[model samples]
Target: MIVRTIRVRTIWSVCVPLPLLSLMLVVFGLTTGEFVIAGILPDVAAGLAVPVPAAGRLVTAYALGMIVGGPVVTALTARLPRRPLVTGLVAVSVLANLGSAVAPGYGLLLAARFAAGLVVATFFAVAIATAVSTAPEGRQASAVAKVALGMNLGIVLGTPLGTLVGQHLGWRAAFAAVAALTAAGLLMVLRFVPASPAPTGSMRGELRVFKGRDVQLALALTAVGNVGVVTVFSYIAPLLTGVGGFGEGAVPALLLLYGAGAVAGNFLGGRLADRALMPSLAGLLAVLAAVLVLFWAAGGVRILAVPLVFVLGLLAFAIIPGMQTRVLTAAGAAPTLAVAVNASGFQTAAAFAGWLGGAVIDHGPGLRSLYLVGAALTAAGLGIALYVLRRDRRPSPEPGRRPEHAGT
Candidate 1:
């Protein structure tokens, strides 16, 4: 008698390193939970018998949680081995999502979302740190990008799917789906991610990295650089419908297009940053500014505007790896804390962008004016990047790690 055995492998088994893949999956789950709320906001508002604006506080609460919780969690857990720490964080997230799924009122749901956000930024920080530490020399940016690619996928696939589930079943079903995703992610992380050595330094010593001017600059650059993209993205639905005259039904398809572009731009940016970090950043920012200006001029014309959405997404994401790499390189000694702080800075910038974009809409020229303001804001960020380029003249190498090249 002959016996045959069956084996199955997932697409995730492609080429990424196992540890990084595990980290990526965990990140994907967290990101899905973070973004799915937007898709289900109206349902949540109705379900809780609250005004849509009040229900909107969940988003703000989560951002606030990230800003406050990242440092606290990272500081408390900084010395632990990466595998368990990350898995533990994912576990906490699973519970938070479950709590969100069962929340009896808006207050409880808001708290659950905050709890969920508590782990996200620090999880990202640790995941990125582990990936970089394990990467081959000179591949730091690629490693960063791979972990970040999970985020893009979450936006592209997870959010939409979760939204679908919410629409068909109920909003609570979406949170349950997110919880299930995190649970699966926790298992994959435990399976594929190798146990890391405990950190050699204490939290206090690691925190000192922020004192460096380069580190400070990297953090500021991240916040300032993202404002342009956030300003447009926050109001994308309105922009498309109001100016481009696209029907509401068309927005989803256009967003999918944008997401596809983001995936492509992310990998491309990673490769470019691996080649020449600072220069690539500068060039991408300049291009992004130009694209924003082009978008402003073309937004009224559907034919031109549709393709610009893809290009806009491409340029917006193309700079992310460079921004992340700079921060990691600048604060090599304190990856966990530095990255958490960077996450907070980016969050703060997003919050500011929302306010600024609203002001532009309410008081300034009009809805069409958003793109111009976005372009101007992007130029301001580009100026900062250029200043860093001029001041550093060469990329600051990661601590104790040899400089890969002068161009970085």
Candidate 2:
């Protein structure tokens, strides 16, 4: 028994990292392809004969697709095999990115981006579900963190990767590379990822999760918290350079520091959630709220801005895995759809935040207002979480150890 246990542990240690890498690659491909368009906005506007602001609408269109597609796909595909569905979605993403590269006009590019958004939303939820399901008992947060790691890496790596490709070869070349990466992710999923049984539930049964007070509160908190963070981050470059007076070269370094902090946050958050789920959530949200406020206060000091950005990244990311864990815990066994819904909620709220931030900035509001908005939203999230924690009072379920639903 001991020898067998050791063998199993060895295999899992090796095998699990493969999934993490593959998941990261998937996020990388999606993010690189999607955000690359932002950098090429000028080129695309000129190519398609549209005004710059109108070209920006393409991004808005893609986000709209993401917000609408995620839950719709989850609800529709509730009965499809999880692993295969993920593979298929990624395959489609590759095709979409490829299409974006060769698209003839703005309308076609918009269509391609919409298609990519559809695939990305589905890809995210599936990846998270697979990670959580595969995690060992008491390690679900870590597993989900692996997916979060992919997300952070994407933000850190994607734009640069896209820029390099576009600079050397053109924006078309960048999209092609992202397509190739997506294809690679698909192959990895097919080759290494084991099949997962479909989540069992009617759409109605899944919707019941919304009826749960904790789930509703959790979803609300996620939306508000996401908006809060994005509000400030949307204007981070301006804040750092204009207000903090950091050089352009320093911006990339600062972003790297933030990425490192995020990695640390993900790992630490999982451990903290494992220790005491509710308190971890509360503490992280509170710190996140405070960090945004500090960013507002520290705007004039470069030294302060650097450390504050790091703390902001840490606090913002720490909430993700814990929030995810919270939903799974409260939802009990059948969490697949609920988890998907939460992902959608985050995306939707981010859209609202981007709009809100833009509105604030448009009014000649300084970058500090971004932090103010973030702080307010984060406080709201923390308040909701606190209320839920107080109401539940029951200890959170152990991470990675989910109860089986009736069908499972």
Candidate 3:
């Protein structure tokens, strides 16, 4: 009896909460759908009778919707129950993906992609908030990271698989598969995710998070750093083929390496953030900048590009947990809204980066210059991080005093 009890306790300790597992599946499905477009852009363009550059705009449209949707949806549904809100969001995702699978024209497909993006940021914000709030004490960052692992895996495992499926079966089939996965995720959420009480705060009160300088700094860091990462990542397929001299058959293997690095970075960042948030963030940004420079210099050589791509993936994602933790910590009174806004910041950066990459490919120095652009943006982010660190060293304001100005 004693041995059995110990074994049961150990199993319980190792088992993840059902709600978290559900959220991870939702994130995985969403991320896979989002990134699969990048991998299969050529096929999609050919199928839709559009140029590849034009099809790339689909990514920008989706990102723009996320930038708008995160804060808008969060604010609008601030008083709703958590389970229903998340479930409904996932349901929307299923429909949007299905629409993508069947859309007959580029315009219709673009609309579907935009709709898909709209729900993703809102879902991610709610899921992260739910995961962190329900986590065991002192394990919040780890819990958040675990949910994010789904995204890392989606990149590592899903994108390559989806690309292969698209290559063999068709891009529409890939979107159909995502729709099916999201439908399954919706069922899991409905069955396992418990209802969470709405946070007690007026819209005005929730908006107070924007008043804090720390929160602003954190959001800015997210935006600029993501710009750096996405600038290169948005054009990765072409970069590998055109600049790295990689064949189409080799792209999936290289992506696998990058994805593996992302998985490692996700957990490592979570652990470091849990221990020391600010320092870890600053270090991650610095490493990211350095890695971007390295990628630019070595991209021409396949041998060097292979390992550098992996390291680049690692350093880029390592900033996420730290950034999320910093935003939540700084937004003491309005974590939910703050997290939503932070998600918006990331999407906004993604939109900008996508546009910038397209411009570079069309008119500027072309694909290889993406690395230089990424490095510059990352270096700027590092400067902001240093400023934040210095600002943190100053004495705190009086307990009852609120700052006079606060708006992002």
Candidate 4:
């Protein structure tokens, strides 16, 4: 049953095979592209002569591209060699980010952002599959976790550092740097990522998995269950600046704190999900709703707001492992397509987050109202989660290890 000799120790292991390490770096670049925009929204708005709320739509556009692009790209390229397809996707991202850096107008920059996002989910699906295919028997979970660590690192390191670049330099420079990162990743992929046979599964069989009710619930939970956190995070820059009275300079530091919380949460979440998937999700969502409420009430106080940012990060990331476990368990038969669907659903929530946060800021109560809005949305998701839990009649799917998210 052995595919090769690759070994991924655990969630905390540092030593990984070069191919997986290369894929990790590539994912870091992709996730940073998704996350850094949040930190630089105010700067991008000013640079492009648009409103901050309007700048938020750049995020929506990128997410919409991912939603549309993942399935189409995967379907079109399913039978192609894995290594070259992965490389081509990263190459596309590099070009798109370069376009973002040089575009003179807001419209063109938005287009560039969308193009950059198109390759993200497809890369993740292929990259994870590549990691799995190359792993020793009984270690697919470790392989998935290793790639997911790239995403966590993107949140913890990439966003804060990228924010610093955008803050000190021009926002355009930030995109350029991401392009450079991916360019480096492309070279490493060429050197390290081994060639693999094209996927043999048909699109018909993959589509068939979605007809299951369990799969349907899992996808809905992914889109709905996570929207609240995504909402607050989308406008986090303005909230901290306007409400917490921090200067734009302070946003990176706060995001760093949030990132630190996310790292801690990622490990804690995996352990919990491995033990009791549904119960843990229900508990995490309930706490997430409470945390959002707390954020709404105390967001203005500088002292409280600081710690609350960390807590919000903790609770938000904590729910991801359980949700991912749900999807992998429900549709493990077509993991690549299953992962693609879940990734799109994850981006769908992010897209909604940009729209809903902008709507709240522009027309509703105000920036602070975003927290309450998030709380309500999370409560709705929690209700949906509880209904799914109550109607359960079978064992929760055990996907060996916690399949940490690439979409966060």
Best by lDDT: 1
Q: By how many angstroms RMSD does model 1 differ from the true structure?
A: 4.2
Give each model's whole-structure lDDT: 0.87, 0.78, 0.85, 0.82
- Tell me the spans in candidate 2 whose CA falls farther than 4 Å from its real position: 1-16, 394-408
TM-score per candidate, chains pooled: 0.92, 0.89, 0.87, 0.79
lDDT, candidate 1, 1-408, per-residue tens:
122221223344545766777778778888888889899999999999999999889999889889988788888988888877877888889999999999999889999999999988889998888788888899989999899988999999999999999999999999999999878877877887778877888777988788777888898888888898899999999999999899999999999999988988998899999999988998998999898888888888999999999998888888998898899888888877889888888888889989998998999999888998889888988998998898777666788986644322
Q: Quote the positional error of residue 199 for candidate 2 in Å.
A: 2.3
Query: Compared with the true structure, what per-residue lDDT tens digits does model 3 show for residues 1-408?
Result: 999998886675466567778888889999999989987999999999999999999988888778888898888888788877887888889999999999999999999999998888888888888888888877888878888888997888777788888888999999999999878877887887777887787889888768778888888888987798888987888989999999998986887788888888888888888887778888888888888888888899999999898888888778898888778888887787788889988877877888899998899987898998899999999998888887776676678885434334
State which candidate, 1 or 2, has the greater lDDT: 1
User: Could you say which candidate leads in TM-score?
Assistant: 1
Error of 1 at 103 (Å): 1.0
Off by over 4 Å in 1: 1-14, 394-408
Clashes of 3: 0
TM-score for candidate 2: 0.89
